[model samples]
Target: CAMASLWMLLVCANAAAALLVCLYLWLIAWPRWKRETRARLKVADDATVVAFFHPFCASGGGGERVLWKMVHTLAQLHREKKRSLHVVIFAQKGPKTPEQILAGAEERFGIDVSTEGGSGGGGSMKIDFVFIETELIDLLHAETWPRFTMIGQSYGSMVVAWRGFQTATPDLYFDTTGAAFTLPLGKLCGARCAAYVHYPTISTDMLAMVYSRRPSYNHDSAIASSKLASLVKCVYYFLFAGLYGVAGAFANVVFVNSSWTRDHIEALWRLSPAPTVLYPPVNVEALA
Candidate 1:
């Protein structure tokens, strides 16, 4: 009778332990993970947030121009449709404020981004800037190991994106820079992800060069000169390309800068909905 009682006690103990684990997962772990996912921004219940990942937000380059233009476009849509749309820019810490960045974009591009409720205008749409520290991203840099540079940076950007959106995730996650790693994280938070890829991380042309053992832009002096070096480099690139494709697969939609880029990305990602070609916007009047 004692042995049977002990056996029953052991069974009860196991059952209790299992129940505790389940309770922790439901009451603690899941909720904690949810809170961590939205740790960055405190979002309004009614607001439709659009988060943009642009590490070089202040840089008045082609990518920055696209970023600002997108903000302007959304602001215009918000005004026309009479909806509350908020734009959040995830960037590395810079001296400029969101207003300053918008102002700088105006000065550099000669485009009007002012909305009815914004500082520049009375537009209802607002732009918020979330700055990520370099230290967070520095851990992912592949400078020490040069061969895996693309994979390292891509993973680093993903980490940055994950943290950047943890506070207040957007309804739509748009990557102005070619960081496919951010897509999965955005999706995890129930955000639709899109990317404007300036160039494919790895192209068939690169693989072809490797396969043919031909010296191309990807093959430097050392790699091109030696057959063994070329073979090793080719294998590295092939592996990296596969990794890149997997990362890119997370994106719901992709927009390439040019037809050339579109073809390569389409071939690599093989996305069911093919990527669209969006030529970089040019200020016709400014150029004239």
Candidate 2:
């Protein structure tokens, strides 16, 4: 058992070292990439940058509504403060141009987030789209990490978020896709990290499932039937839960989409005021 423990420790340590090496290489290129990205986008030096780390912001899903609404609201509020705001979206994959994405948002959500679209709502906020590589985005997908998916995707997200840092460093960052792993990355880049957590990466419900020895999507019959396997999964989930709590602690603010989400986030993260329940922006009037 002691030797088994040592082997596991070595594996985890090496994986962590690999991630660190990637981060180091990314940091080495960051300053040069930042300057180049800023110049290419024509971003002013003094503008407050709010980066939304949603690789699929232009997808126009429920999350996209929230994304566009936040863009509009933040733009409007900053205009009232007389501060120049630059909203940069780290889109997962983009063949569409920024104008095309903005047009899609307006067409789908009826929200005009364009600074130059002459929507009367377009204020002092300028918009830029930073398209991330498709391969990097796929790292967050479940198929990429079939075994130990929770931890796999958590570390995978850190890599994808690093790609965003290689583009432009923002004053503020919102990991709108529930990538809690990226919160620390944002903080490391000197940005005030924020998250709109739709669901926790590891939840107490998942823990309970493993405890009850239930076979479900996350756990197959083989693991559920074997007592030893269930015990191993329990330990994995417990350790992950602890690590997730630590990662979540780095967020400057957390906004959840529902009361259930709020309960889980609070239980895990234990924030001072608790994570605020900022439900997704849905257009009821438009539907009617």
Candidate 3:
């Protein structure tokens, strides 16, 4: 009778474990990972599609300056009558239209992106703007997730990122902003991924704060004081740190803002060639 009961207990435990695995795949893996991707951006077959993933391109911020600068630089290159090149930016549609966004870039940052799409900058260069629902883009904002801001933003980015891919897949994917979550999506789509990161999603400083149980703006005092809560959070961060590193490694090139960022990305990414430090170029003329 004792042996039979022990056998029954082992069987029940195995069944419970199998059920949990099934639930995880059904709720998490299949929806987020197993879906197919499709592109909606239309372009000529021969043209090289270079897409910039900047959801807030019209914000007129420093990052927008950098984004438009690159776009303008490409526009200049297009004027040279070079090979077929199309620059498509993935942005969240706001009250402003795409044309308005271009005009704002010119007016605010003195960077112009108002080029003829069909004429291809008088050669074979073209520019286009893409967008999704504003709500999806809002996921990137910290305010969207009161709890687990880092993980929430990261997961929300994947939604935005995957949605962009479902709209269009570019030959080369560039993220002007620090949305590293999108890197893996580009990788999955067989596009070369690049990033200009001001900061990483998970950094050593964040780890130290959680480790030391220090309450700050990001860390709540309640969790910091409770040892069990702190330990739980530490585990969450530890697992997320692994995911962050894995996503970063998918990028072909990573450009950090400073040497400090370079050190962190290097340790996390573990790439063969270290990430290059690319400072944001100041528009001295506009600033003046």
How does each model score on lDDT?
A: 0.76, 0.82, 0.79
Q: List the candidate 1 regions with Cα displacement exceeding 4 Å.
A: 1-44, 115-122, 137-145
- Cα lDDT tens digits, model 1, 1-288, are 999999999999999998797677556654565454334344444557788998787888998888888888878777776566777888878677777877888899876676445422225566777788878757455673376677678778888887777555677889888888777667666678899999877799989887777876557776777889888888888888887787778788888899999889978886425898888899888667
Question: By TM-score, how accurate is candidate 2?
Answer: 0.84
Residue-by-residue lDDT tens digits, candidate 3, 166-263? 66767789988888888877866667899888888788788889999999888899999999999999999888888888888878888888899998
Query: Which residue pairs show collisions in model 2?
Result: 55-92
Ranking by TM-score: 2, 3, 1
Best model number under TM-score: 2
Compose the digit string of candidate 2's lDDT tens values, residues 1-288.
999999999999999998896577557645466567668767666667789988888796898888899998887876675666778888877588888898999999999776773212224578877788898888888999889898888887888888878777777899888888888778777678888988888888998999999999888999999999999999999988888888888898889999999988888886423698998887888768
Q: Give the lowest summed-lDDT range of ten residues in model 3.
A: 31-40
The deviation in Å at residue 62 for candidate 2 is 0.7
TM-score of predicted structure 1: 0.79
The estimated TM-scores of all candidates read 0.79, 0.84, 0.81
Better of 2 and 3 by lDDT: 2
